[model samples]
Target: MPSDSDLVTVPARARTSTTTRVAKVLGLLVLAGLVISFPSLAPDSFILSVGVVIASYAVLATSWNFVGGFTGYISLGHAAYSGLGGYGTALLITRADVNPWLAMVAAGVLVAAFAVPVGIASLRVRGASFVIVSIALVLILLLVFQSWGSFTGGSNGIRLPRPFGDDVLRPEQHERFFYLHAALLAVLLLCWWAIDRSRFGMGLKAIREDEDKAQSLGVPTFTYKLVVFVISAFFTALGGGMYALWFGFLDPIFQFSILVGSYMVLMSLLGGIRSLFGPLLGAVIVGYAMEFFKAQYGDTQAHLIAMGALLAIVVLFMPDGIIPALRGLVNRFRPQAASIREVSAAELAEQRRAAEDTGGSERGEKEEVRR
Candidate 1:
């Protein structure tokens, strides 16, 4: 006969496996439904445009997570690559007459090329120094673009021709852009999910947890960080290019702003940086909140104040971010419930055995007295 311990352990393992599978299937189904229905269900162009904005930010946040969340290298200068991508795509399309799609790809490639040297240089530093390097890079790019009036349109910024041209109605244009952004976000998420489960991702996490320990264990920490950094830059730039095409304008000030960089970091942190879907969740919350605040409060400081409050709340209450905190809560209760059931069963078993022993002892005493 199987021991009680074996019986309990086997069922627990089976239940956990079944639960995981069911959860994954349900999650995939929900995601599929959203992807297929969002555009059709959206009420108007305004909603679609907001969706596009959310998706764009999602892509940015997720891409940023490639390096920042996974590798624990909080880069404050990712805007440099994003801005370059915007300008690169804009220039290629406007000056060279390339297709917007091709221009987007080229822009990503260009950003990745640029990231090689930057990653090599920046990855040498740690923590605060790395952050400073990132900020400096973005600042330099902002200054260069702002000053170069002839080439990049300087303070005037550059106007971009819409990908679908002026013939498309505003509503349709927004709908198309919304889908495009969704596709980009989907791709980013898929890549993140893949990497999150990969050996390479394990190395990145190792670096995130302890770089020195990772290196001692033969993980090429520097190489891994730099590679992830370049990959992050590539996707970030693609998102920037898409934004440029969508908005039909690009401004150096807005593109390379510290605020944009901060938003990427904040979104990732607010959602749960360690999880694959953290950035997407964060983007939805932060993106919608920003839009709502701006629409309601106009150009006042109210939005900023609200954002600050939100940040403070997240930091104070959910230090590990919403998803992780919620997960932790769920895990805590789940185990307790299981333990309660097991304890009750064990208690019943003990009571039965004790009762039998007591009854037998009494009977034996009665028999002895009779004898």
Candidate 2:
């Protein structure tokens, strides 16, 4: 008895709700399996190392998503905060002999301590100017790290003892680190996903679309930026700690290089910047590609050349990345898929419209007879 519009719209919400529920159940099962298997079984060395690297990168990339992707701030200075985080906690855990776990806490606090001051100063500059200033800060910090030869080991770089015992770790240690990386990644993703769907994420999106409009709407623009900056730096620091742990060393080039910054950007861009899976895809693709190139070409430089080529191809052909590329291809190749959705909606709307029109005519006839 409803209008076509009403019937169609009613079903739209119901269909969406059903689809979301089904997706959630399947996603949960996959996540549970990934988490549960790590403790029970052992992964090969190559697999374990690769997993740690990808998982760690995912954390960094996802953190970057908060401000970079969602808020429209393309940050090339992510390395500055991450390196500071590594050095901050690395110093505490190494020199002060704090627990590595506690060191990670110190890293966050320290990164945030610096982030607040820097963010306050940097937020004064908008858009391109702000980005430039942030990058300059990274260079300045890197110089500072280099200058403090006693603490940071200057150009030579400082080292951190692995959280593992003094004895050379057995195969089990690699698996444990793999699980740790996985666990860390899962926790970070869960947090990011929640934020991405929350009121905060909505506010951030508004700010990204139009900061002036968002600010006019009583969104605390400065506060949100500061909070996102600190939170992003926090996770980046955690990932930095993981990086240091994985390699058992930290070098200035590794920590502060433009390449590291580029890697973060590349991962986000290649994966599908806005989606949750985007960073993961970018990391997996880029990571595996490097290994593949290294094996095939027998030179590290091959990665750079291959990456540049791949990036060019992706930018030219699939700038939206693999996910969007695949979706577009599916829609193009099988027009019926999207047509099916539109058809269903249109059909329901048409049926409801007809029902309403018929009911109206009946009412009119009945009224005339009564009269």
Clash counts for the predictions, in order = 0, 2
Candidate 2 local lDDT, 196-227, one digit each (tens): 89888888878788999999999888788778
Per-residue lDDT tens digits for candidate 1, residues 1-371, read 33334333234456888998999789978976896688889998898888889988998999999998889888878888888999999999988999999999999999999999988887887788789889999999999999999999998999999889678998888788888888888899889889999999999999999988999999988889989999999999999999999988998999999878878988998998998889889999999999988888898988777777887787688757889988878877665643546456765566556656665676678789989
**Residue 266 in model 1: lDDT:** 85
Model 2 clashing residue pairs (backbone): 4-352, 4-353
**Winning model by TM-score:** 1
Worst 10 residues of 2 by lDDT: 1-10
Off by over 4 Å in 1: 1-11, 337-371
TM-score for candidate 2, please give it.
0.81
**Top candidate by lDDT:** 1
Among all windows of 10 consecutive residues in model 1, the one with the lowest summed lDDT is: 1-10
